[model samples]
Structures are given as structure tokens and as C-alpha cells.
Target: MLPNVTVNPAAEKFMRRMVRFSGHGDGAGFRLTVSAGGCSGYSAEFTVEGAPLAGDEVLAVGDLKVFLPAESRLMLDGVTIDFSDTPTASGLTFFNPNAGACGCSSSSGTSAQPPGVAKVDISSIRRN
Candidate 1:
């Protein structure tokens, strides 16, 4: 089954741009793979591909297509995807309302990241 994922305007725009500039023709799409990781509870990597890979499912966001593997589909359920660009960090961020509070030391009350939100820095993601 498809996950109930929400793509905010910024993320949608980013994905659209990725596919548009992929130079892979009309079927190109943004492939996103996410998993549980670190204090924020999520780690992600993305790339523009000509088509969905084996075992990947296509998720339609307006006219744009997002290719999600099985693990990503499970992780993204009821999650909101957003993009942020700032002096400190810039990239896709995931907000899962059902996520639990992080146990990391930085999350001991005065954390930069709020509970249940994972910031996937573009610099940290390997584009493949």
C-alpha cells in the first residue's frame, strides 16, 4: 500500500526541479529512500532517475513523480516532507507526528531540532 505522505510546497518544488533537470526525458522522477537514524529518527538519500527501480513504487504529487522503495513507503507514512535553505543548513526535512522524542544528549530539552523532526542535510546526502 502507498504511504500517506505530505509534500510541502518547498519539497514539491525541489523534487520537480530535480526531475526536470535530470536530463532523463519524460519519465524521470525523484527517487527518495529514507530510514530510521540518528537523533531525529530519519536519514534520507535522493536522486533523479529515469524511472522507478525494481521494487520501487511511484507516488504522484501533482504532475511530479516520486519513486519510493518499500522502506521509504513505510517510513513516510503520515509524514510531512519539507525543504529549508538557510545559512546554517539546507535540505529536505521530515516531520513525523508519530515519532518519539530523541534520546540524544543534544535533545536534553534545549535542542535546535524539535522532537519528531529530522533534518537531512543536502551536504550529508550522497546523490546516487
Candidate 2:
């Protein structure tokens, strides 16, 4: 079974802008992928692509293109990508509902084996 996914209005608007900006010259759509590396043993990756592969989540946001791999769709359910500009820097942020408790902490069960059954010492993590 797969959870629900909702695209935030802000992200949608940003995506639209990216489409317009890229479509004019020499750009394409955004490719969304889930790769191994995050605290949960996997992290999401985004790239620009001129086309989409088979079984991809092809969402046309204005002139921008959005592509999500079939395998990544389940984990990305109810995810929203937003863009923000701060005094430090500007970038796209991701919101995923499936993330386990701990918020990408190394001590969290997300990155542990057995899939959420293992226990971790929070105190130890804080000490480090």
C-alpha cells in the first residue's frame, strides 16, 4: 500500500516558475529519485532531464516538467518540495510524511537495520 501525497501550493508555484525559466532556452523537466544515503538509508535526489523514462511520474507543472520514478513514488507519497531564499542561501526543501521519528538523526531507527525495530541511544548521540 502507498500513502497519500499532497503537493504544497508554494512548491507548485515554484515548479511553475522553473518550467517557464527552463523552457525558454535549453532546459527540460525535473527528475525525482530516491537513492541510498540518508538517515533512513535512502535519500531523495532531484535532477533536470529533457525527457522521462517509462513508469515515471510525469507531472506537468506549467511549463516545468516533473518526473518521479515508480519505485520512489511510494516513499514520496504526500511529499512537497518548496523553494526558499534566505540570507544564507536559497534552495529547494522536501517534506516527506513517511520519515521516521528523529529527523535524519544518525541514532534514529531510520538508518538502522530491521526497519524500525532497532533501538538507539539518544543520549549517546547528543554527547557526540
User: Total clashing residue pairs per candidate?
Assistant: 0, 2
- lDDT measured at residue 91 in model 1 versus the true structure, 0 to 100: 89
Which residue pairs does candidate 2 place in steric collision? 5-78, 19-64
Superposed model 1: Cα runs more than 4 Å off: 107-111, 124-128
- TM-score per model over all chains: 0.91, 0.56
Worst 10 residues of 1 by lDDT: 103-112
Assess each prediction's global lDDT (C-alpha) against the native: 0.87, 0.53
Q: Which candidate is the best by TM-score?
A: 1
Off by over 4 Å in 2: 1-3, 23-28, 40-42, 60-64, 103-128
What lDDT tens digits, residue by residue, belong to model 1 across residues 33-86?
Answer: 998787888888898888899999999999899999999999999999999888
Worst 10 residues of 2 by lDDT: 119-128
Candidate 2, position 68, lDDT: 74
Q: Name the lDDT of candidate 2.
A: 0.53
